[model samples]
Target: MHFVYMLECSDGTLYTGYTTDLDNRIKKHNEGKAAKYTKFRTPVKLKYQEKFTSKSDAIKREITIKKMSRQEKLMLINKG
Candidate 1:
């Protein structure tokens, strides 16, 4: 399965991405080897995640989440 995931950073910012392994993905994010965004905003907590059968679907979800305003992102995360 692929995952569309959100992390709430220690700095109160949010990060979104698509991954095949949620556990390893979060580990990579905390280790500063995930996305460039999460690299600088380390030590994130997994706030939300959705599983999809296809990577394309997860990536599409990631793109939509990334385009959202902060408020909208927060709403999405909280809803998850």
Candidate 2:
């Protein structure tokens, strides 16, 4: 399964992305081996996630979440 996920960074910022391996992806972010944004914001915590059967769907969801304002994103995360 593909997954779209949000991370709450150590600095209180949010990061969004999609991955087939959720655990590994988060591990990479914490290890400073993922995206540049999260690399410096290490020790991120998984705040939310949605599962999709297709990679395209996961990517689309990631984009949609990325476009949301911080308040909107927080609302969504809280709902989850």
Candidate 3:
């Protein structure tokens, strides 16, 4: 399975990305190795996730989520 996920950073910022291994991805973020943005913003927490059978679908969802305003993203997370 592929996943489109959002993370709440320690600084209260949000990040969205696609991954096939949610737990491992989050662990890499916490370890400052997953993303340059999340690297400096260590210790992020998983806020939301959506699963997809195909990687293309997950990537598309990730892009869509990344374009959302913070408030909109928060609403989505709340709904999830």
Taking all chains together, each candidate's TM-score versus the true structure is 0.91, 0.98, 0.97
Residues 6-49, candidate 1: write the lDDT tens digits: 89987998888888989999999999998888888878999999
- Name the best candidate (by lDDT): 2
Clashing pairs in 2: none
Better of 2 and 3 by lDDT: 2
**Cα TM-score of candidate 1:** 0.91
Candidate 3 per-residue lDDT over residues 1-80, each given as its tens digit: 99999999999999999999999999999999999999998789999999999988888889999999999999999999
- Assess each prediction's global lDDT (C-alpha) against the native: 0.89, 0.95, 0.94
As a whole number from 0 to 100, the lDDT of residue 29 in candidate 1 is: 92
- Give lDDT tens digits, candidate 2, residues 1-80: 99999999999999999999999999999999999999888789999999999998888889999999999999999999
The CA lDDT at 1 in model 1 is 96
